[model samples]
Target chain A: MAERKVTVTSEVGLHARPAATFVQTAAKAPFDVMIAKVDGPPVNAKSILAVLSLDVEQGDFIVVSAEGEGADELLDQLVEIVSAP
Target chain B: MGQVPTAPPPTLTGTGVSPGIGYGPARVLVLDVPEPEAGARHDGDARAERERAEWALEQVAADLEARGARVGGEAEQVLHAQAMMARDPELATRTGELIDRGVAAPRAVFAAFGTYRGLLAAAGGYLGERVADLDDVRDRVIALLTGRPLPGAAEFAAAGSGMGVTTPFVLVARDLAPADTALLSPDAVAAFVTEQGGPTSHTAILARSLGVPAVVGCTGATAIPPGVPLLVDGAGGSVRLSPPAHEVARARRVARAGRAVLPAVSSTQVSGSHLFRRGMTADGHAVPLLANIGGPRDVESALAYGAEGVGLFRTEFLFLGRAAAPSVAEQAEAYRAVFEAFPGDRVVVRTLDAGADKPLAFLPPSGVEPNPALGERGLRLLRRHRDVMNVQLAALAAAATKTSAKAQVMAPMVATAEEAEWFALACRTAGLASPGIMIEVPAAALRAADLIGAVDFLSIGTNDLTQYALAADRQVGSVAGLQDPWHPAVLDLVAATASAASGAGKGCGVCGEAAADPVLACVFVGMGVTSLSMAAPALPAVRAALIRHALAQCAAAASAARSARSAVDARAAAEAALSRT
Candidate 1:
């Protein structure tokens, strides 16, 4: 099991569409994916409720981690997604 | 309603904004102040305490004077007033009296603050009761506070707050707040005259919506007490007490004559040829300038301004100020009307963005409120209130088939790649075309390359982008300097979104303040923003600016603007481009 902290880059943050997006992407990944507010603990990314619990806004740094193949790339993509601009 | 209308009231002397005399009515108004509770204990110990409180206030006042001597303007006055409260002898004397009575420090301060504050408030209360003359209230107030009789109304504006009116009278007030505007019955009041309020203040918004003329920042406005003949020229931002008979006669004549001419634009001004031409830059470069309308009234306004199209049709207002959900049929009728109004123009309708700051009157505002800016609004609101979203979608889908106008639906406050997918899926299920998301969130910008693929077009809402970018409110003066569109952070975000959309051969436009700013117009145009939507009135200047600058010059201008520190700097850099060939 692994987790990497990342920021939410979308203008509105991770409360709405982005949170749902994270859940969808996390569900597609090979390993169990989780995201959390940087100041908080990791939670299931697939669950919209859990993802939103992160309260991630644009520029918020949070951690994303998953176990299994391509988890690193997944984290990288998630990071890119969070800190886009 | 009779006769070709005699000349409007003569040109009235009022305050000046940029400097100019304009004719308007004599709006006599009284001020409304919150009434304070009565009853209190007055004694010697209380006197000593009051002295102490006065001393404390003096100290604060001294401190403000010291600081104000160095810094001036609006900020100085703001700080100085606070200092004045601190220096006020009454505040010190009252507090001291309470403290001597064995009251705790906080309690003593509050108690003292209350008693003395109450005295002034009582006077204000008395003034409110009289509503016509404040001289009586002023004398009683000054005598009570300073133990000295006050002067006459010769220095009237200095005596007390100004008068207020709900009817068609020149309502002179020290300031106009939300409450003040609320008291103005449209039928009774012809216009608003305030000694204070910025162009962007709520008072201004409300006043404009009511079609009432307004003048702000009038000095010594309270001079014209209620009933004493005075003229209020809101257009000139001035007030004159007892204008000579000649000036009054001249005003009435000019007003009657001016009535024949369109004094100002109306809400439904989009009907004329002024809006007929494609809203483009002077140089032949086309930039769509759409209007973000609220409802029928705004639609009427948009059409009046000849808005190219409705970039954002906010659906939230429909759910608010109403008891129940607007049914699919009702919703369709409205949407159809909008589409019908602009047969060839595009109407990119945004789904209900009602949650957080904007709650649905008919439904439970998604209880998810810790951080509404980052919470369920826009698409999430739709998911939470699917029935509402479906009804809107169904309406739009049906309306689309019947109307001549093009309808492209957009979702707001979207944050992720998958959310775009959901929006796409939902739009498809509803049989709607050109479904997209508002890339107002930074995360959405990061996945822009992918997100744009999920939608047909992109419209970046820069207002929220700037807020989330610097974690600053648009209204806070202290942090206003940092709320720059040119900030590397913001520019980078906008650039990324633009780049992604461009790479995918998709269209992207910015429909925020920056888009409509004359100075930033070229910069945005350079950034490849397909359309720039702003307040309708801002169209001409922005159009003029765009026409002066070429597209090739725009890219470099954007880059130059990107390096600027604030909006001011960005504007300077953009303006610099116009100076050249």
Candidate 2:
């Protein structure tokens, strides 16, 4: 499994447009992708409802993980989206 | 039936949140989306009911996307996100499961949404607010299933059609939900009148952003029958119902003339227009008009509105919403950008002002106090965290060396001359020039001469001065009326501060909401305030007002205002004096 921990820097955190874009990107992955708060249970990253329910805010840290080829590239893309202002 | 002669409809009054005039037919927004019955059950065939629920959600999602495409920009992004909520897979699955258990489609959808609503509401703050958006989506789906018209659907459709309607509507409502306003544009809604809302309400903020005239907290506004000709004066806070044809014509003529007199001034054409290029009185006393900005992002609007320079460049933006203070290099980069925007012009940068309403995560207070407002904040917070203050000062010094902009630094919430001296010495050590201190505390204003002697200049923050002098908490709504800077007591403090700065042969500037008021701008100049700075959008009006009156008239008006006992009387006296020769 390829995993990366990134901080959400956008003022609204992982919600609104950012959450929608995140979920849409995860849906494009060939295999299942998972996301969770540090030390929290993982949930399906492609589910918009699950991501929003996490209620992640600005300055929060979250872990994204995926297994298979191209997993590193996908995780890198997700990290860029969350960290961009 | 023949037309019967009747008395004129009564005029309704409310607080004017946005400034403009609008005349149009009343279109009352009815929010009557009924909740689906909880015990409702589907027929024996659960599969058909499940398909019906899925179909309804899909239709609502497609409709939202269509409206979003028509209203491009920020509104479009909002509608698109709402559409996502409508087609959420989790929502669809939950509804399908409920339908399989013999629950009706409408009831199943409602229950499914209710679960998410509870979770968002429990999360509070920004997340809590999203519950409203979720509820809006749920209401739309249920309305479709029950065969009822979606609330505000007609207005949304009209706004999205983009076919310039013959006469725009003056939307009258009890209060508008975000969904109702997401698709509305200025062309479709001439004005907005609501029965409940204050100056800071969502409706007021949205109306101002869209530049649409709006009146809020209007009693009897929703009672007005639809299609009645309503004339709204947003500045005057009056809504005249079924006004005479002649009166409406005259009002429209006046509004048109006002617009013609002050077309939006752009930076490219500012040099060509002599009247707006500089802030000067009729007698030609120059008082440079500046803009109060948060950071570099605001430079474009400030330049667009022809800001001569930056009056109050708040440095707190760099420190806010962060785990720690930004590095010196990062801070210098941000400051340099702002300084570069206005080459050869003054840029007064206020140091990190966090505490009270705005507390930083890294910088904690010494102890818990009964009142945070009166506790250690601003300069006091920086004093304890000297490393933080030194880094900021070094960054300012570094940025100033790289730009031609005349960078000036100041400390906020300085109560005594000793604090002013301490801050000034620190700036001098860091090689920053002309360090000043804000006169927000009553003690600072009362002993302005002593404090002014310690700094290079003085900037009067009238908002905090008013709050401190009148013993009124600015955050409390009930005490908001007391927060008026026009109060004679607050005016007295301003006069003292400006006089002290002048006595010390230093510049004095007013950088508060009070300066945005054109009439008050003139009065500040009269009280010996050498400069006026406000939000960029208010520059044109203040410049226009200043150029219409001479320095002597403004002084007389200031004197007249000081003699009055109350804020209302003071404003009236000043207006009366300025009107006279």
The best candidate by lDDT is 2
The candidate that wins on TM-score is 2
- Least lDDT summed over 10 consecutive residues: which range in candidate 2 chain B? B1-10
True-structure Cα RMSD, model 1:
19.8
Which segments of candidate 1 are over 4 A away from where they belong?
A1-85, B1-276, B366-371, B475-478, B484-488
lDDT of 2 by residue, B468-564 (tens): 9999875554566787899999999999999999998999999876897899999999999999988776787888888779999999999999999
lDDT of candidate 1 vs native?
A: 0.60
Q: What is the interface RMSD of each candidate, in Å?
A: 24.6, 4.0
Taking all chains together, each candidate's TM-score versus the true structure is 0.55, 0.64
Report model 1's chain A TM-score.
0.81
Q: Candidate 1 lDDT, tens digit per residue, B1-581?
A: 01221322322333332211232344434333222223333454655645544554454456545544444433243334344345333344555655666553334554544443443334331111211222223222323343332322211221112233223454556565342243234444445556554443344444444444566655445444445455545445645556788986776676556543331322123234454335554446688878766555566666655578888776664564333467888888888878888888888888887655455434444353567666666787688778878888998899898987889999988888888998888898999978977888888887799898889999988777887787875433345556566676888788889899889998888876566567676777788878877655455556556655678788778888787777667667766865677
